[model samples]
Target: MSEIVRKESFKHVSYLWDDDEAAKLAGDEVALLIYRSNLLGADLRLTNYGGGNTSCKAYAKDPLTGKEVEVMWVKGSGGDLGTLKKSGLAALYVERLRNLKNVYRGIEHEDEMVELFNHSIYDLASKAPSIDTPLHGFLPFKHIDHLHPDAAIAIAAAKDGKKITKELFNGTIGWVEWQRPGFDLGLKLKQCLDENPGIRGIMLGSHGLFTWGDTAYESYINTLEVIETCATYIEEHYGKTRPVFGGNKIESLPWEKRKEQAAALAPILRGFCSSERHMVGHFTDDERVLEFINSNDLERLAPMGTSCPDHFLRTKISPLVLDLAPDEDLSDTSNIKARLVPAFEAYRALYTTYYETCKHPNSPAIRDKNPVIILYPGVGLFSFSKDKQTARVAAEFYINAINVMKGAEAISEYTSLPRQEAFNIEYWLLEEAKLQRMPKPKALSGKIALITGSAGGIGKAIAVKFAEEGAVVIVNDNDEARLAKANEEFGKQFGKDVYITAKLDVTKDEDIQAAFDAGNIAFGGIDIVVNCAGLSISKPIEEHTDKDWDLLYDVLVKGQFKVTQAAVAIMRKQAIGGDVLNIVSKNALVSGPNNAGYGSAKAAQLHLSRLNAAELGADKIRVNVVNPDAVISDSKIWEGAWAEGRAKAYGITVEELPAFYAKRTLLNEIILPEDIANACFVFVGGLLNKSTGNVLNVDGGVAMAFVR
Candidate 1:
């Protein structure tokens, strides 16, 4: 799609409608509705993830009546506008929906309206209608947008919102007092249009904005014009009194220092938040968040909470604002932890009280008491959720709230939704039902794994297996090219936000720390570590030099030690018992000629795993080993000399090595990298979870190398 750039004097927001994209879906009202929504939703300034609803009314052939009738299409419950699809839209008979008001008893009976909405659906198989459906269906216009754009919401959240609305648009835009969205609110909008008779749009109090036109394009333009006007007004007022939020109270740390603090703090925060269920973390040091956190009014504004219901729902009623005084040292980890522990406990207590205060007879059971978002004065915001995307989106939503607060405080006093009102929406019976319908989480749903040498071979197999079980993985490798390839393949398989990449050498302490830091910044911290990075050099003892021995020990033994040592520090800080699975070898136990260096290194790795198991048992950190005899398939260790050396040691050609190794096993099976990965998973996958210091021989029944 292309745009004929508008000559309007508007700044602050763009007019992104592309004629070519619209033309492709010309005459398809639903597609155009989706197009308009994508453009509005593409920018966070316009709306947030799954925040608002958009709709269009058009004539459609009623299958039952075989006659054309007006039908309304709206974003389905829990659908994000940016990714709205035909399947994500609910289609309903407009007249039937409007007629639902006839059966509506009152606001108390609004929860029952959904069953009536189900009956009004034009197609029974259409996506379920959201609670916001009435706000669209009851409207008189052919097209409408209910957006929580920051500019629009800034005005809506202001203390004098109604008066400001009246003066800003000069009667073109009307205002409706704050009311929970339902049939009653929809009817109030209808009443406003009736009473005024000529208002172009309406501003929803403590909520969002409504703009409509006969066509989708026209509606899109009206929305843009309304938002730009609000932006212009806010900026004009903001200029006179810049440095809003009552001016800055604390100075922002240097850019790198802020991120360093965030990285160091994320795992601890994630562990505290994961008390009930393991939670993934997302960190953002974006300047906007910094501006707000460093502001003097942060203490006053943060607890009042966000005004918009969308922002309130994802971010919770309030954030856990860490008490980091301006004079406090950001690098003092112990002092930070001391304050955080008590602060977290207090937040939980507050939430319990809030739930008790707002409970109705039929309210849903109290949910997890952890706050979704956390803020610190010198550092940035960290959001926690079951997976990375939700965590990231929750962080994004709070930033949207920050923007809303910025504009509101710049112009007028900002206010929050009534406590009871926010609670009703959060714990509403309908919202509970939505939560109930969610699919069951995977076994390792919130566990994060960091797999060394995951760019290929057995390491990659372990990574894929872990990710498949709902664990987010940090795929680690020293090879840049291989890491990129692994990243691309993993991304294709698992989509974004579930996995991250770390390029590092396990042999170097700096590299190991950087890897863990990357994991902390990306996913809080890892709960599983697979020490799978290794290579082989099979040679006669007489021919083996000091270089060969050092090289072998450095990669196979020392590398695993360094990575696990770093992982233990993180696991200890998180206080989350974790899994450390070492990929050893049958060579460690079985005697063979021309294998002195490689075999001794494997023995060191095996002993280290056992020692780690004994030493770390009190911390509940499990260390186990998997010994696979021959995992030559697609392995970098078996490319040239290693393969030839192993083949020669067995008195066979490279092509015959597989068959020979298989025949040597009692079960006569050729072991693969995946078999080794399966053994690794068994140690950590809750099957053999209680048994640490264990050895699993995945050599297809090679009795000579059996653990016993």
Candidate 2:
């Protein structure tokens, strides 16, 4: 028996399959395949994000023929296994797939082969099939799994991987030489399987593991068996190769200290990364990253690049390492900035050379030359992408690569995929076509914004608008309950990574700093600031109290000033021009009865915006005004005494206040929070992007409030 078949239980990797869960879907092979895939994908040790494919062959009734047909259900292209669902699996006609061999011209017609997959699709509702569909279809097994488990890949990427596979799995596992994944690679997998009838699986050279069986459980268990056995073998050899990664060359910073350093460097690195196109960033101080970066071999291995296609496709060909002495202070950002400029320039030049050296006549043009993954020895890793989730997954994939490198170097000499081979995969025509099909990025795609008082009212509306247009938002509000609900709402609307929340009381400088600090660290830095935090009191000049004036000025005038100042400092540091929007009022321009403290504070806020706009224009920071009068829906202020105060000012009941305000406007329409939000988007959403130090009113057209 093959060593993998003889193994009854796992020794290294976790056996996550619960018989009860499997029994619930026993009759459905496709559901069982999805269940097994999720279990394997949930563990990063098995596969990185969107890294592997799984499939099972099953009998399905043909709609037109009314007869059972052999069909293949495989994970679709760009689908994550852990989150795989019925919609994520592509259904293909197995007999049709098998017949494609007659038309398979050769590997040179790979792109044409992908087009043929459309012809073999069994279900119209099915997602697009993956490139590895042929790898599973050509095999004889009823079920199959192709995973990039670190341990197996360690064996696959080792110099003596083929030799290691023979000894490790005995006769049960076979091996194939390195080839980029495509129809040719699929044929090689089939050849390996046909030649070794008794083997349970094959190891794809410098790539990953392939395991199969008759049933879903059998296939899933067989995979765990192979991976766990390889883990056990690597561990035994790893013991002999003591001091992994040639031992850590520098002591890792304390967890808190490392986070502090990461926060400081994130924006600076993000700024450099945004040279070609603005990029959002994700930071990680995970122990895996800390250990790898602090190691002596990191300088040697990180530059050599990642072995697995999954790793390099996300992390790029090589990482840009920002090494520092043990005693060097990262707090001196200027010093770090000086080093990063040259480092980024050199990395871009080298990447361009790689493209020039390996370009084929029809190869895709060179992509973003900036390093996707950036390393800071004492801090951790920072990954930059067009959006939050991509940036985060890039970091996670790099961590997986770190594990693979550690294992390979422990048991055998680690070898990266050849640069030419990597270049082929990176610029493949099929991959380029996939990228082209993605929807164009939104206006605020790579920008991060901070919107104060964002738990509700105009603030939340602005936050939601920005998030919709593809900006990561820092939503700030002082109300704990409202903030939590906003968090839940935003998480449900947009995936959780798109926005973050912070408790903010605009009157307090500490709270202001905390919010900005949270914004800077969570998302590289804030490129847009909207100051909408305010409360109003409609009182006669004599009746206005010291408490009333202080509160109004605190939130409206002074608070907006402090937040803008903080945002500007970071914007200047980022060297990327930004947008500053203030939510002033009609009261700032037009004098009205029964208004003293609130109107004066708003007037001060209005002038402060224009003055800052005048000075900050030199920094390319555009400060503008969105004067929204009587915004009522979902407003915290309108829900409380402010409504009563405003109603009293108009000599009307609170219920009649909406109509009273609307009647006064030129358009005779009630102003909604969303209306203000739409106006805010106009200023920063690249529409009125050039018009700064200007005012746009969103009050259903209050004629007196027009900008001077």
Candidate 3:
């Protein structure tokens, strides 16, 4: 029987090259290639951050021989093409690289291939070349660009991928079946080029696309042409029928309402997905993600596999789809927990079976078998990862995958690489070794920390401390300007993407809920919560007004309660146990004269920590109190009327008051905000992993206030 052909009219591919700007960069070829790479990298539709590679070959004077020789300048490992600089491309002598293929007397292992590639580098100062260096090196073209564009992958991952490629590009493109990337795949690519000398591009079935030309513009424009052609094919054949969920579905809450719902659901999902170690949860209700989650065929379609094999590295083979009842109340903690527990258990069992069946005997052991993407019916999608940035990256890729899958299913049935092929990519020794070479994470790495009133003083110190230790910090404060400043400073110190900021009023329930949601969305979930938001009010018992009492209690006691409640709900749901540190005043234990309202509310806050410890110990949640006495350095709390009052009461000026307080301590040391932060870290950093309901004093040894 003759095969049915699917024809699609070609669409114009957009180019982003700017000749005026390109004129400013160093070398003509290098500048043009960098410009082209940034153009491709800037568009997530073309290629996302660090997801694709580009290269150009030029003749350069060989230092030792003083003869013109070919050198390949390819995108280096660990560099993003979007913001690529000339230095981002690794330079290697093309002849030296090609000669290594002759040196290859069939190696028994893949690691040896990587070693051989490393030794071929011509410049010692250049960054390490990407693993696909050989593929670009062997191809007989002046310029080459390889990208896993969603449009191309949609066509490449179909059941009749080869037929589709032949029909679309006809005589101009060659198609290769899926093969694990290494020396073998590189050799096969060279063979394909040699056999199809007239072809301009090659489509790797169940992989991605590669296009090349004699010039940078030719190669870049050709890549866009291929992708645009595939996109047109999907559009023409698919008929633009939007995916629809068939059943009588529960009405989804609005975006803002769903965020609140996510905050409630995150903890439960985190707990269910967690092992002995905690896993953070990030929630997204993106329009595309919502469409996928709401699809009637979601249960069948979502679990098939990733849109491309590269995605398996981030999202794993498949996402875990939850069978959430339409009528179930997501606000009810008990109901959500009950539903997630069984769903998680089933997912674990299925994951174990998949791993056992597909993984090679030599495959490295799985890190954490939990699914990275979690599709919660009414709540949207929750992505899990060791840290916030990784979780966000996974979400970005999965969102793209969802769109690709939908597009493929619309045109033809969406298909992916076989189970074992995905397993090979996931456990590939070359990829695994890259991760092994990374530096060890800090003590609190991958943990998410939320600090209230983090704009200055002790709160700010704690935020910096946690961030320095590799925790994804959620900086919360009512002061917008200071919060932005803090966010910028943290970003400057640790890449801006490391921490997120939330403008929050701890006393407000909506603010508390929103902050938690932001943290959950930024990272995966909250692991540590520190309640350090406070204000000082000193007055005699009879002189204290109701307003003064209310403000003091609202911030110190009630505010702490609400934030803790939100955090505890998430922690309990994540089931990975967490730590809660309350920054209480030493007045909580020893009341000073004329400080009735402040001391009383602080005392209440201290006792509340004990109550939470007792209640949440079974859940493995630890609660402790940090009682800091008269912290004077870098403290905004001691700058106003409260400072003058305390100083006057101590029979000294503000400058002398610090010394007075220091002498009161048996150790005679002035307590700094950092000192308080250190004590706070001891509890939240798991130094007291076995202990809770404890009070750690940072008063430089205030004998009376110290708790034994």
Candidate 4:
């Protein structure tokens, strides 16, 4: 008989709270309670600047009358949860906030929203109630605590997230798909409660978990218990591995030396910070950081993925792994600037492509196409904030997230929330409002994407795919009439705001950058890049020429490298994660006749894709290759002369080519642009978040099937 394997239960954490002190609060205690809330904000991991929010509901008597008045002391807008003051927690009529939820769905006017906002009894000094007032009011519980717990999210990001959730919650939980968190979320929760009357808490998909209790401590305990349990489960099942990003330990360094390093790198901060108040700097251990610098695989893996979307608010996607000689001195900043500029340009190009592909005409323009913060090998992270506090808060969030991602990746693949889903949440008004209430320490809005070779076929398909998700796409091709017609057809279904046309050569760097710059200037920054620009020439090696090889390399490999390099630079400056997808042929891996030059060029492109992925990983720049075959189109292989020659060589009629290719695959069907487009979006978006330096084959199972 097989031995019975027993699964383990989750461990819970006890929050240290002074119960007697908390329960003894009277009118005089309001000041102290508010003060305590502010103290918690200093721990940026929990509440980065104005991330996690807190509130207290109480009944107080009117000054002039004996009648009881019910009010909620909630954190105010623009107040960091860590450094909040007694006055920072606004006193608003609880009845009014509850009332707003009833009317929120029906009201569509901005004026009414502004009017309702003004009615609250906000502290004369602080900002409005934290954006979570609606969520708080809608909850039946008196006190509520919400946080984007990194541990919980790390568990939630696994391949078996659903199974884990079932294990953790058992049957007494409610799961809600990610929705704009506001009045809509409130209404949805109410419906969920109506269905599952006995549920203890809810988990927001692609977001985080929610728990509450009658008292503050109970609520806090509930939140911690959920996180602790998830963390323990993850540690046990996944088997905990030490963080790949290294530990928080810092070696002793002289204050003067640290200051000197900070002084040398301050200019990079100046461009993105846009102000001095938000500037903060730190230096890392010389030996440990260089360990990553020394290893090629480590350099490639570091920036391969993000811990969470929240990281964008700080370190963006990745950091720069500086070039250092084995015996060279550690304090050199000479090579830093040279690397920084080109990295920023590459980031911009990617950012532009992402923005163009994702946004429609109605979407807002881009903003801050440069990274607001950065981390360098042998140096700690640096960020520009509206104020010093902001910089620290942003850095803290990213640092923890980066650590979590590295740790998570060690156990299994580091996955990301799907790109379309991330876009939906990012653009959702309710979520943005919550961010706005906190001064939005990190800026990620208004980015564009420009997809080239997009006039019908895979290029056009990818362009439309990005548009539906959230990006303003600039479609380009050599065929003007075809380009115009494809745009019109796509526009009729998606809308006119979906596409812009550019008749230009993909081989020219200036042409690509100019198109990218125009798009970025129109928006603010570019966020994603998909290189579907390619062509195939099928002639025996003897018939191929130096000119043919050069043209093939220029289109398939060199063009993509140039475009990707430029895009990475912009994204680095913007401090945002950018994606690059190269459309290479499956023939590179498994070859066919008279296609040596084409296959060889594609192989070179595929290698460049990985090299780029390795070099740019630290900048939050990801590069991957897509290998597709049997994509029926007007390529040289399917045309008149080539088809006739191929038919004669194979001793089969030209009409049999489609069936021959299709039957060669496990699934007998001609691959379409739409199929390739689906894979393209999945990679660019967050579906393959933890994937880079990966070669994904969307060739209809051809990799597994053998040809007769």
Instruction: Give the TM-score (vs. native) of candidate 1.
Output: 0.97
lDDT of 2 by residue, 416-491 (tens): 9989999998998889989999999999999999999998999999999999999999998999999999999998
TM-score of 4: 0.49
Off by over 4 Å in 4: 1-14, 26-45, 61-70, 106-127, 237-280, 284-310, 317-336, 359-365, 377-380, 406-413, 418-708
Q: Candidate 2: which stretches are off by over 4 Å?
A: 1-12, 326-334
lDDT of 1 by residue, 591-698 (tens): 898999999899999999999999999888999999988887879998999989989987889999888889989999998888887777778777776889988889
Estimate the overall C-alpha local distance difference test score of candidate 4: 0.59
- The ten-residue window of minimal lDDT in model 4 covers 1-10
Task: Give TM-scores for every candidate, taking all chains together and pairing residue i with residue i.
Answer: 0.97, 0.96, 0.91, 0.49
Model 3 lDDT, residue 307, Cα? 54
Clashes of each: 0, 0, 12, 59
lDDT tens readout by residue for model 3, 429-468: 7778888988887778868899899988899999888888
Deviation of model 2 at 551, angstroms: 1.8
